[model samples]
Target: MLILAALLASAAPVPVASHERLSVIANGEKVGSVDAVRDHDHVAIHYDVKNNGRGPTMDETIELGADGLPQRWTLDGKATFGGDVHERLVRDGGTARWTDAMGARTAPARGTALYIGQSASPWALGLYARALLKAPGATLPALPGGRLRLDPLGPATIGGVDYRAFAISGIDLSPDLILLDKDDALFAVLDTGGATVREGHEGEVPALAALATRLTAQRYAALQQRFAHRIDAPVRIRNVRVFDPVTGTRGDPVSVVFADGRITGIQPPDAVASPGEASIDGAGGTLMPGLHDMHAHVSLESALLYLAAGVTSVRDMGNDNAFLPDLVRRIAAGEVAGPRITANGFLEGRSPYSARLGIVADSEAAALDAVRWYAARGYGQVKIYNSMNPAWVPAITREAHRLGMTVTGHIPAFTNADAMIAAGYDEVTHVNQLMLGWVLDPKEDTRTPLRLTAMKRTATLDLATPRVQRTIDRMAAAHIAHDPTAVTLELLMGGRDGAANPAVADYIGHLPIGLQRRRRQAIAPIAGPADAAAYDGAMAKVKQVLKLLHDRGIRLLPGTDDQTGLSVHRELQIYAEAGIPVPEVLRLATLAPEQYMGHDQQLGSIARGKLADFILLPGDPTRDLRELHRIAMVVKDGTLYFPSDIYPAFGVTPFAAAPKLTLPKAMPKAAGAGPAHDAMDEF
Candidate 1:
């Protein structure tokens, strides 16, 4: 049993009732602060984060009971993408209950059950660890669902103060690194840039951030091992309606045979299974190419989730420089079960609003150097970011071209899409980046939420206007590609708390509780009927933009700027709503991107000799776009993964029973096979 050290050394023993502040730093930058007061047994904390990632401005408060139990907790703030997060949890006697966007839920107050809502801070958990020091086991109960475990990694020091390090898991999408003082009070919250340390010690950011990365990576490594499924024998999928993206048609029932990580045969439904092979019954479902999420910032934690959702590949937009390459190798080596990633070096300019991912260059020469750095590492593309100087575009684009890397990115804050296209942008990143050009003033910065808020201007812009037509004509003539990421627009437009998201409407209840609730919050400011109409109309105008581009010869790449899971389906569905047709929507998510990447021959379509990468949908997506959500099994490079097997790790229920497998009895070896399936139903 152990407790944190004494109060923060800098704070010393408080002589009287006082209010103080703690600095919150992320990646070496001061992004937020926390205010707190302590009076005997009662301690109150107020936490706020301003610009760590996407300006999740939060105001959270917690009041603790004398018994070291949480008495009352409340959080009112905005989350990533601007979703309002307002929640409260109260404890009394032997019960604890919470009220959030999903309404009310209850749990026992004792034992492992604690009502730590999604809005609860990691600091709260650190305090809980101190109280449970001599209580019992390492595992503790969590409200809503799941359990949290604290593994003390022993003594460590931060900013000359001795503390104990602990990794908190099962609370977030990933584990977080934290530390407690000698008396078990929350001492630090850590990330890659630095530690959110007690006030005077904010200079210790770099050391803590490096440590956070190592600890987080170690936890994810164990997860990867528990999820990856490997196959030894040839895999045969029988009785499937094969989807051929090239022809935009779902053919009659067929039996597909794959082995040695390649598709070997496509036979009639009546074909007999070969000896020494494993077979799965597709039950006359549509077998289509595994989807591609063209815009992603993937992580080790999200790797298996992407594959589980039938997204077998992605075009990584940007990430931690040292991490992305190693992760790609881990996935490719079958050390982890994640989607194949085509890396894109993310470049941002050194500005106050600059994102802290990838390389941030301050000058044209530095930007060119960053481009070469990515190209030398075989990165597929270089994505420029919002804070970038528009003047550096030509030099950066020239260097990337010389190094054979394609150019794509935000249309820079002060510039328009036309200038970027002429400056050699092979593609644009998001629809808002392009549409804002039509509506925003030259001086309005797209680096802030204004890029999203200004979309309302589209409500009055005529899509048929010559100014708009000229832009469309140039895009068509240049064969410029647009990711659109229409789902991002939808999230900004339609996410009203306590409402169903049409994008994932069918899957709301089936997803993890926290995620299910988050889907209901609005991400942008919609103050009145007028603002709401503008939001709705802006969404409509973008679809018109999508429709016109498709009608013309402009390339449209379907991408999920958010989580690739389920959202990619929403992206394609939005495309279908714009009258692109379901067949083309499927193609956009599959063969189209494969062709753009110049790997169609080896990757996309259901044909002999290509890599065995596809998904089995219980229903036909060509007729009903929503049917894509009914994913049963996913195959990546001939390795089979049942969504039923992978989902539970992330607290999601399996969508369907995986195909029953019959492996050769003698000596079949898979590099990384998951546990045998209990949910499989044999044909």
Candidate 2:
């Protein structure tokens, strides 16, 4: 991959002031700022950022060569959970190099290489795109060696501001969007939830974000136009190791065949295919059921991301009642790229501290009405939120169960998991939520950030004590499942600054450099020895609580409340750390969720007549859970997508090559590019 942008002398790239700044807002709160300055043949950028309510607090800087590419980049502060960042990239013409957690590395540079670094700032993409994206595939081949392909989607408008846009590919499961103004300056950095570039125009986010969503859909549609293979004949995966999530066993090399979204045949290795059958050479790789992320907040963007990561299915824990149904419908109709969704209704109560998400109810009858509302809308589960009234929970759960929707969510403020279970909660949301009762008082309002900040005190609790064990036993007896989003807990309360966190260390280098720097930012406050000690204690508490829950026969559901594509793999690793066996963990990620959602017979295991929702991996995930990251191909609802073909759009180099497939004669060609897709009609 490109080490960093090469610094070269050139004329002014854009009209500039000596210094310019933009306010950084997160969740509607102004938390920090980004400062940019330009001089003759030189530019510098600085970001003082903090993601609101449990995110990185970081300080970052980037210096551009006269050519407007990175010359030097540096970041320092608390990121991810908390880690000191000391990264620098220096390019002296022919060779560019840098030093990071992976150690020093050097690479040849073109001197005129027109590319951005892993990413110095969200604004940098638009800055570079302005100079590079004059036409399709214009700047890609010249980019060091990352093989990045920037396909300019053409001019588009956000809040009616006419801006040029492009889809950035090469690093993740999905491509991110970059926008430039009419003057060719970055209008904004548009990602899934919001943007950081258009700092002063928060009001435009909803409109820009909506536009971003539509743009991504168009790109994925084009991808489908290019890659999706639907032959009239049967489809077969040959010479592969079939993994049974139910048995945790890798079957002998066999050929699995399916068509019309159902597996129709399983034959011995080397079996001759029926006439006109299409085949994919699996080359002895493992074919396992697609993974399930049970704790997801569904979005149009995350849907594509999850599917690309081999998560063929996700259980959306909570989301916008207005947005999800349409997104889900489009995905089901094969109009969008995403996993099968089992949605959960978000139930919240109006309060001063209540999170502004999902449905809000003020009375018992309103809560019941909310339950009916979700049920009528086809939600299979109802997720109660932190600010919900404990007194109203029993009635809410009763109504939800009566409406055939399972109850799961945060134990309402001031109530324990045991109390929620007694109130008929089928499942508890996060590991911290399950254990918080052991460390908090009745008056502690969990609706605010305190719900997360207080987890450190759990370290002081003895797992064997009645206070903690009673809940475990009650949950086991009641068959109440716990969604232990372990990755999130560690991120919130674990990891020391400057130390390599095992949860992210192995994969950090593979992520986009900007995300790597972002991951290094801190979340929890660690002001001193006492504070640090509490953080340390929280990690132990997580292990103990999870172990006790597992050892005592309490059900533990695997999911990543964070982005699950790669994080889900880390979730399994964390489960293994808690002494859960690898095979069990794999089952927990696959068959377990399918069974819970009542789709086991139609999905999950790679059995006959099952839905063709599975992935081809380079290695066996049953043994090393991290192997899940090396996705080769994903078959969702019988439509095949190659990671090799998908990852680059998001800036990720493919970890493995796609299995060989014989293309059908009917395969479609790339549609026209250029002016046909220009966002500005008048232009």
Best by lDDT: 1
* Cand. 1 TM to true fold: 0.89
Question: What are the per-residue Cα lDDT tens digits for candidate 1 across 275-384?
Answer: 77777888889999999999888876778778888999899898888778878887877766689999889999988788877898999989998998998889879999
* Runs of candidate 1 exceeding 4 Å displacement: 1-25, 52-54, 76-113, 117-122, 128-172, 175-177, 190-219, 674-683
Query: How many residue pairs collide in each prediction?
Result: 12, 19
TM-score of decoy 2? 0.80
- Residue-level lDDT of model 2, residues 291-367, one tens digit each, is 99989887765676687788988888877665677788878776777888888888888775555457778888988
lDDT of each: 0.77, 0.72
Model 1 residue 520 CA deviation (Å) reads 2.0
